[model samples]
Target chain A: MTPIDKNSNMPPESEAAAELLDTQLDAALQSYTVDAPSDLLAARILKMAKATPQQKQTFQDIETGNIRQENVLWREKRYGFGIAALLLISLTFAFGTLNFAPSDTESDTAEIWLEAAADLGMSDIYDWVEGQTNSMDDTR
Target chain B: MIYKADPDQDVLTGLMSGDERALKELMRRHLDRIHRTAMRILGDAALAEDVAQTVFLKTWEMAPNWVSGKARLLSWMLRVTTRQCLDILKKKAPIYTDDMPDISDTSDLADKKMIKDDSAKMVRKAIERLPNRQKIALTLSYYENVSQRDGAEIMDITVGAYEALLVRARKTLKNTLIRDAEISTERPKDDRKLAL
Candidate 1:
């Protein structure tokens, strides 16, 4: 494309005004520098990178209090929720049609889970699912 | 320091390979320029620092995946910073509070310092009044001296769009300053006499 100013002649006043702003903006740009952070934030980032191993740099660990990372976390949570919903819908359909089990309401399902746990000597697993306060840490 | 040839070409490589000194050197070289672009465009020192932090953090995260020779590292960083600033502006509803940084009268002779400070403040305010796209274009092209093509790429617009943005930005600034009686109508002053 031909440059915008090639053919048309701007009024001298408008032309001069543009020139003045060019000078003014140039000066402002020249004068402004961001040294607000006494230490360059890069230093802090490098330190954090050093502290965290690469594989261990999970979203929650790195995203705390960071606006940009929090945005990514927001999208990730939405995606995770979508997948979980799809999986739940698939499982519900499968269990109903495949006769994996007879239809049961919430309390009936809970009872069945408890009975199965007892049969497997996994009653403690039910307690674990319920977030028990216990000495499992000592065992570990 | 251990010798590594071609800091610019290999810094991203080293960064991905977990080289601390490479990160340090990259910071030393480009941090000021990148930070300055954010500060100038956003016109908020506090927000600019946050933007800078996010930009570098992003670079660190993405360094391993950066295709060498595809784009210059500094351009990529500035592009990120620009986008961050734009995002903040979108959230803030474009209310550019007139909280110009306080001027230090101790810089030069009293009269000269005051004029320079006044001019700088006026220019900043004029810039703040611009619409967001104009602000981005002016900051990237005029202020940061990024080439128009690179500025367009950073803005995610074509080069023609970038030039049009600059033209409109310049026009708006000209009209606003003239109408406000902030810009001098006198003959353009000598370079040494210019405040900024």
Candidate 2:
């Protein structure tokens, strides 16, 4: 046995022991081997690659696709808003036109016209109006 | 000096053009190494195969824009395999205890054969008992014969850190084997010498 040195951390014997241990470890690692991969592994991988879609390779391609998608969404939204606005305006116009009522001034003017016609005793005008209304009813 | 064009460059060009033959050729060239590395790290043949398949699929997808001369494709694949194996080991750390089943079939064998088989089994179990990073370090440095620099790159650590991991792995493995030797009466002296 070799004498142990107090100052040095590893003596010569311990160094030799460490080397021997490393040799044994190397030998064991060399001896430990796994079986080869199965023959079907490559074939299976090929089949999977064929079935799956490949991703876009470049960042440029990915960015372009994203921009196109965004453009389509923006177009859809713009058309939707335009159509909605058009519908709202049309509904407003239709409601206003259908629900119109005669104003008080117009009603007074019509009453005055009626009184004047009565004072004039316009029987021919009345007769002509009645004849015209009868003709419209007959046509209907 | 004859400038021999890299064959992998040709394969990369073909893969970029969506050639199935190129993919097949690539697999033929590197699949065994990838599978072996994965198997040694994971200790499961099925999971190793899945990892190999996934790595190749990623290769196919990335081949179109792959730049030449940055790093060797095989090195990249090995790095991916290491990462995949680590992920798996982390997820199922509890299942890979030291008392896991032995790999060798020792039934109806001669005494000498049984002894050799037992030694190999003990070595394997000792390796499997190591932590995930240490196991990977040992596998890369010893079994795969990967250079320390390359191993560091694959593991994404500093060279000093990689060396430290490998030293720890070897020391741990040696201690475990010595402990097993003291516990087992059936291990022959010569077999013990060979294993540890």
Most accurate candidate by DockQ: 2
Q: What fraction of the correct interface contacts does each predicted structure contain? A: 0.25, 0.51
Per-residue accuracy of model 2 over A116-135 as CA lDDT, tens digit each: 98889996889899999999
What does candidate 2 score in Cα RMSD to the true structure? 12.1
Interface RMSD of 1: 8.3
Q: Write the per-residue lDDT of candidate 2 for residues B51-78, one digit (tens) a residue.
A: 9998999999877667677776777889
RMSD of each: 18.3, 12.1
Off by over 4 Å in 1: A1-37, A40-42, A52-140, B1-7, B95-117, B182-196
Q: Is the docking of candidate 2 incorrect, acceptable, medium or high quality?
A: incorrect
- Per-residue lDDT tens digits of candidate 1, residues B1-196? 1223333776877776767787788878877777777777778887887787778767776665565666677777888888898899879855543232323222233333344335566566667777788888888887678899888888788999899988878767655544333223221443344334
The candidate that wins on lDDT is: 2
Which interface RMSD does candidate 2 score? 7.4
List TM-scores for all candidates, in order: 0.56, 0.63
Q: lDDT per residue, candidate 1, A11-56, as tens digits?
A: 5568774565566545544553335455847667688767754332
Supply the TM-score for candidate 1: 0.56
DockQ of candidate 1 against the true complex? 0.12
